[model samples]
Target: MFFKRPTKEVERERNQRLLEAVYSTKASWDHARETERAVYEANVNSELHYRSRIQEQKFLYLYKIARKFKVHGKLNDGVIDR
Candidate 1:
C-alpha cells in the first residue's frame, strides 16, 4: 500500500537522522577528549588553562548530544552510563 511504503520511508529517515546526530556528536566529544589529553601533556600553562575550558565546552556539547539522541529514541550511552 502507498501509505505503508511512506510510513516505512519515514521511519527509515527518522532512524538516519537520529543515527547521524548521535555519531557526529560522539565524534566531536572524542576529538575534544583527545585535545584535552594532548594539551595536558604539553605542560604549557596558558594552553592547559584554555584546554580546561575546552574540556568543559566539550562536556556540555556531549550532554546536548545525549539529550538529542534520547529525544529521537532511547539509545545505549555506554561510556556516559558507566
Candidate 2:
C-alpha cells in the first residue's frame, strides 16, 4: 500500500508527537535540576556543620590551655613568695 496519507493528517500527527516529546524532555530536565539543587544544599549544610564542630573543639582546647597556664602562673608566684 504505497498510497500516501493525507497531508493534513500527517502534519497533525507530526505536530502532536513533537509536542509530546517536548513536554517529556522538559519534565526530565526539571527533575534533574531539582535533584542537583537538593544535593548542593545538602553538601553546603554538611560543610557548615563540620566547620562548626571544628571551631567548637578548637575553642575548648584553647580554654583548657589557658586554664593550665593560669594555674602554672599561680604556682610560680607562690614559690617566689616563699
Candidate 3:
C-alpha cells in the first residue's frame, strides 16, 4: 500500500525543527571550543608566572650566599661581584 503524502504545513514544521536542531548543535560546539581555548591560555599564563617567580627566588638565594661569603673574606676567588 502507498503511504499518504504529508501536508505542506506538516512538512514545513518538520523542516523548521531540523534546522533548529542543526543550529543548536553547532552553537554548542562553538561555545565548547571557545571555552577550551580560554582555559588553555590561562594555564599557559599561570605556568609562565610560576617559572618567573622561581627564577627570582633562585637569584635572591644566590645573592645572599655570595654576600655572606664575601663578609667572611673566604671568597677570594671573586666568583661573585663584590
Candidate 4:
C-alpha cells in the first residue's frame, strides 16, 4: 500500500481517535465485568435459598418418620408398651 507522510494535524487527529476508541473499549469492559459480578452474586443467593428449602423439607420428613415410629412403638427391638 502507498502511504503518505503524516502531517502534524493529521497525526493529532488520528491519535485523538485512537485514544477515544481505547477509552470507550475500557469503559465497556468495566461495565461488562460489573454485570457479570452481579449475576454471579444473584446465582449464589438463589442456590443458597434452594438449599435451605431442601434442608427444611428433609427435616420435616425426618420429624414425621420419627413421630410415626414413636406412635406405633416400632422403634428398635421392643416389647409393645401400651
Candidate 5:
C-alpha cells in the first residue's frame, strides 16, 4: 500500500486557503462588471439627452420659419349700407 504524506488536518488547511483565494477573485470580477455596467448606462443617458436637445432646436427653428411666412388680412372696403 502507498503511504499518504499530507495529514488530514494539513489537507483541510490547504483547501481552505485555495477556497478563500477563489472567492476573492470572484468578488473582484463582480465589482468590475458592475462598474462597466454603470458606465454604459451613463453613456446611453447622455446620448439621449443630446438627441432631445437637437430635436428641440429643430422644432424652434421650424416655428420661426413658419412665422415668417404668415399672411395678414387687408381691410380695404368700407362699411356697406343695406
Candidate 6:
C-alpha cells in the first residue's frame, strides 16, 4: 500500500522531536568541551608545579655550593694575609 501523507499534527510532533534531539546533542557537546578544558588546565597547573619544584631544588643546590666556596675562600685569604 502507498504510504499516506503525514498529518499536520504528526509533522509538528516530528519537528519537535528533532529540535529536542538537536538541543540535547548541543548540550552534550558543550559539556564535553568544558570537561576537556578543565583537564587541560589541570595538566598545565601540574606541569608548572613540577617546574617550580625543580627550580627550587636547583637554587638550594647552588646555594649550598656557594656557601662552601665562601668558607674555603675565607680560610685561604686568612692564610695569605698572615
Top candidate when judged by lDDT against the true structure: 1
Checking candidate 5 for backbone clashes, the offending pairs are: none
Give the alpha carbon lDDT tens digit for every residue of 1-82 in model 4.
3687878787667655554444455455555455556677556546544544555555455446445434232233444556
Strongest candidate by TM-score: 4
Candidate 5, residues 1-82, lDDT tens digits: the string is 4887878788667555554444454455555455556676666546544544555555455445434534222332554444
Deviating ranges (above 4 Å) for candidate 6: 43-82
Cα lDDT of candidate 5 equals 0.51
Better of 3 and 4 by lDDT: 3
RMSD of each: 6.5, 32.7, 31.2, 31.1, 34.2, 32.4
**Which residue pairs of candidate 6 clash?**
none
Q: Residue 21's C-alpha lDDT in candidate 5?
A: 47
| lDDT per residue as tens, model 6, 1-82 | 4799878888667655554444455455555455556677556546544544555555455445445434221133535764
Model 3 segments more than 4 A misplaced: 42-82
**For every model shown, what is its TM-score relative to the native structure?**
0.45, 0.43, 0.44, 0.47, 0.42, 0.46
Model 2 scores a C-alpha lDDT of: 0.51
Instruction: Count clashes in each candidate, considering only residues at least 3 apart in sequence or on different chains.
Output: 0, 0, 0, 0, 0, 0
Q: Write down the lDDT of every candidate, Cα atoms only.
A: 0.63, 0.51, 0.53, 0.52, 0.51, 0.52
Cα miss at 54, model 4 (Å)?
Answer: 38
Question: Once model 2 is optimally superposed onto the true structure by TM-score, how far is the C-alpha of residue 61 displaced, in angstroms?
Answer: 59
Q: In model 1, what lDDT does residue 58 have?
A: 59
Which is the winner by lDDT between candidate 1 and candidate 3?
A: 1
Error of 3 at 65 (Å): 72
